[model samples]
Target: MVQMIFLFAILALMTIVLMEANTVSARDCLSGTFGGPCWAWSGEKCRRLCIEERHVSGHCSGGMKCWCEGC
Candidate 1:
C-alpha cells in the first residue's frame, strides 16, 4: 500500500511537470532534408534559423534532416 501511494505521488508529479511544460510554450517543429555540407546543416545552424523565424530551438538529425522548432 505504501509503495502504491509513492508511485501514485510520483506519477502525479510527472503529470504536473508535463502540464507545466506545455503551458510554458507550445513549439512548432519543422523537419526537412538538406544536401549541403554536414556543417551547413548542423544543429546550431538549424537552431539559428529557428531563432530567426522566432522559434525556441532546433537541431539536425539523422539522414541530413534539419529540425526547426518554434513557438
Candidate 2:
C-alpha cells in the first residue's frame, strides 16, 4: 500500500511538471532556426528579425543563420 501511494505521488508530480513545461500562454520549449546571409543582411540582422517576430530569445548562429527560441 505504501509503495502504491508513493508511485501515485510521483506520477502526479510528473504530470504537473509536464503541464507547466508546455504552457499555453507562452511557449516554454518550442524553438526553431533559419538560415541567413540573404538580401545582403548579416546574421545579426536576421536575429533581430526573429526578435521582431516575437521570439523569446534570438541569436546569430555562426555567421550563417538566425537561431531563435520561444515558439
Candidate 3:
C-alpha cells in the first residue's frame, strides 16, 4: 500500500513537471551565418558585432563565422 502511494506521488510530480515545461515558450534555437568577414574565431567578438549590427543574439560558429539567432 505504501509503495503504491509513493508511485502515484512520483507519477503526479512527473506529470506536473511535464505540463509546466510544455507551457514555457520555445526559442528559435536555429542559428545561421551572418555579417561581413570574420577572420578571428571569437565568441564575444561575434556576439558583440551581431548585436551591434543586427540587434540579435549571436555566437561564433565553425570556420570562424559569426552565426546569429533568428536571422
TM-score of 2: 0.35
The sequence of per-residue lDDT tens digits that candidate 1 reaches over residues 25-62 is 33545544323643433767777776776666766544
Q: What TM-score quantifies how close candidate 1 is to the native fold?
A: 0.41
Off-target runs (Cα >4 Å) in candidate 3 are: 1-41
Q: List, residue by residue over 1-71, the lDDT tens digit for candidate 3.
A: 99999999999988876764443234323233355654545667767766765646765433445655555
TM-score of every candidate relative to the true structure = 0.41, 0.35, 0.38
Each model's RMSD to truth, in Å? 8.6, 11.5, 11.0
Give me the candidate number with maximum TM-score: 1
Candidate 2 lDDT, tens digit per residue, 1-71?
Answer: 99999999999988876664443343332224344342334545655666777876554433233555566
Q: List clashing residue pairs in candidate 2.
A: none
